[model samples]
Target chain A: MNSTLLRTSALRSALRAAAPKTSSRAGLAGTTFVRSKVTLPDLPYDYGALEPAISGKIMELHHSKHHNTYVTSFNNFSEQMAEAKHKEDIQTQIALQPLINFHGGGHINHSLFWENLAPTSKGGGEPPKGQLAKAINDNYGSLDAFKEKFNAALAGIQGSGWAWLVQDTQTGGIQIKTYANQDPVVGQFRPILGIDAWEHAYYLQYENRKAEYFKAIWDVINWQAAEKRFK
Target chain B: MSAPTYTLPPLPYAYDALEPHISAQIMELHHNKHHQTYITNLNSALRSQAEAVHASDITTQVSLQQAIKFNAGGHINHSLFWQNLAPASSVDAKSSSAPELIKQIKATWGDEESFREAFKAALLGIQGSGWGWLVKVETGKEQRLAIVTTKDQDPIVGKGETPIFGVDMWEHAYYLQYLNGKASYVENIWNVINWKTAEERFKGTRADAFRIFKASI
Candidate 1:
């Protein structure tokens, strides 16, 4: 959010908070709300950073065009949801869920997705070092085994989706899961890693050879990036 | 003995049956490869999920819903899909002139041409990978042909609607043959529709509804 939008949002929140508590008006009936405008986060590396595994063209389009659209749509939906909630419009709020899930996932999944890759020169694809390494060993037997399972999960998504390694919050264990069409990790799973399986993610470069795409993506997996989240 | 896993259902016709409209290559890949992958993963998820539940592994059980739903919906949807199509013989014998079915379709859509336009428009309107369906569903007291779509592999049954027929709109369904032009895929698929199967399904559901109504009376 820009500084101007920040000030406006703060002012709106203040005005709502100052409204009479005894009022029966729809908007004033609700407590003060501070809704943040979601903006697309910049990639940590150049578009061409993860060369050979992913192309600069795919990165640029995926980030600027695809991810940006998600951010823009999420913001729009967020604004609508805020308005609906303020008026206590249950039906409208319910209707906004599908849009929220899709665009919100696009924003969150892509945000996590970009950081999960790094240039090979920046130690991308290097083996894990700390707790994540031990966890991978304990849960999946070995890093190679984890990669094999993850690749199979990726290749096996029936349509557009994502493959993830997530922490089972209840058990404090890791498991592999697939999410349909931009759905981020739901349920009790906290995602530790994710790869976009949408055709847009790899279709241009790999065509229909998704096995090749999965194979190459591992070559660019940022263990260091993953480790920080795992810890 | 072990519990039976869902096996891939074979296509009713040869890979070449839907030719020129949806090529053999697309059919083969869609069925043999894509459909099979869903079942395989579903089976895997089912096994682990069963064990997780048996052992009270709540987290694993919860996390497995996506796998179970996506792959099972893939199976259910595709199984209906194969039976939904046939060799290009025009609307099939049963529904071509099925008065009641045609009446409902016309009532809901104004006319046959209007229904086609509306159905195709709904299918084309899907934002991403999903399916477009023509389903017979009750709203208040009347059953009507409600054209709807679902994202990814969510089947119509999940939405409390009995699908009369469905068209796969996933890019994998036609990208090999139609490329980016889904309009052509939607238009051509009509030629191969197995309306006989759809009519049978429609009649069966209506009969059941009638039976319940008569029982109540």
Candidate 2:
């Protein structure tokens, strides 16, 4: 993991402990805030590790630059949000909400994305076992069927966005979903795994060849990690 | 069963027709790639929504709100936007053409130049993806011009006001040519504003009070 991301994780834990009862996001009414600046989380693996699947250059830019901008912008928005809340500026708070969503979504989606993948050597393509496997089979017929449906959702996204395997909040049933831009399906559904269908994710290596990139991602998917989350 | 799909509204002029102000490349990509995607997604959302209604899955239907709104707004905004623009060569600035519209704008903002500035201000002041609209609204038994901005892909049609004209503030509209300079793109856009079409829209909206998006659709 990037050391900054590690620090961010540590800070998040500390913040959770520190402000367990209060809120500061979007300039909502809240108590004093313990400053929490978002930081770029390091990619868990080397850039070249996803090689034949995703080029090192793409990975580097995605993580270092793209994700980094989100982190920095998120932090800035957070600071501004805090100031607005501090001053009880309702109009300013309303204005800042979109920026918060955009940057916050980028931060969250990218952070989850880094954890969502692993190199081939580390059981990336390994299928789920036990309860997770049973659940997949029950809901989607089979793992292959799940992939087929999920990739269809991925391929159909209108613009920059992600296709996700999200557990429905109501029934805990897994469903394939897509969200445009940096939107993360975290509020009503529990996102188990996400595949970025953003052009930047594949434009470099695949160059508008989305279908090929969708197929290639299976080689680097950290199934073991995702299954652990599902269970 | 026949499906209701939103078709991309044909540009008022040729793809390269806007020229110098809005490059053919920008218009082509904006129409074909961006606007086309919105139409496709809107169709898919409406279809799935119909299925959810059939299945009695209210939760799933509710879950699709963002998709429905965003894509529907995209389709509505773009369709109106294409009609609101024309080639610079096509415009005849004869004040006699839209005397009433010009008089109303002048009354509202003191002059056309100030109205343009106010519109630009509303647009430049926007924080993220959205649209800037010049609308004819009845504030209190008086028809007046109001500058409104809607965030992301939210349409202006349902604002209880008739839209005179609107500019797509989405980055996809001008990012290639304008890059980060949205003000520049918006500034040049005025050169192609179809006063004649806007006059017709104004008259049509005045003809029927309930002529917004949902009502017309």
| Best of the candidates, lDDT | 1
Which candidate number maximizes TM-score? 2
Q: Tell me the spans in candidate 2 whose CA falls farther than 4 Å from its real position.
A: A1-36, A42-69, A85-99, A117-134, A151-162, A167-174, A177-190, A196-220, B1-9, B19-21, B29-76, B88-130, B139-141, B149-156, B169-192, B203-217
Question: On residues B56-79, what C-alpha lDDT tens digit does candidate 1 reach at each position?
Answer: 999998988988999878877887
- lDDT, candidate 2, at A13: 49
Instruction: Please state every model's RMSD to the true fold in angstroms.
Output: 9.3, 6.8
**Clashing residue pairs in candidate 2, if any?**
A2-A42
TM-score of chain A of each: 0.85, 0.88
Model 2 chain A is weakest, by summed lDDT over 10 consecutive residues, at: A14-23
Window of ten residues with lowest summed lDDT in model 1 chain A: A14-23
lDDT of 2: 0.76
Model 2 — TM-score against the truth?
A: 0.65
What is the fnat of model 1 with respect to the true interface contacts? 0.25
lDDT of 2 at B170: 66
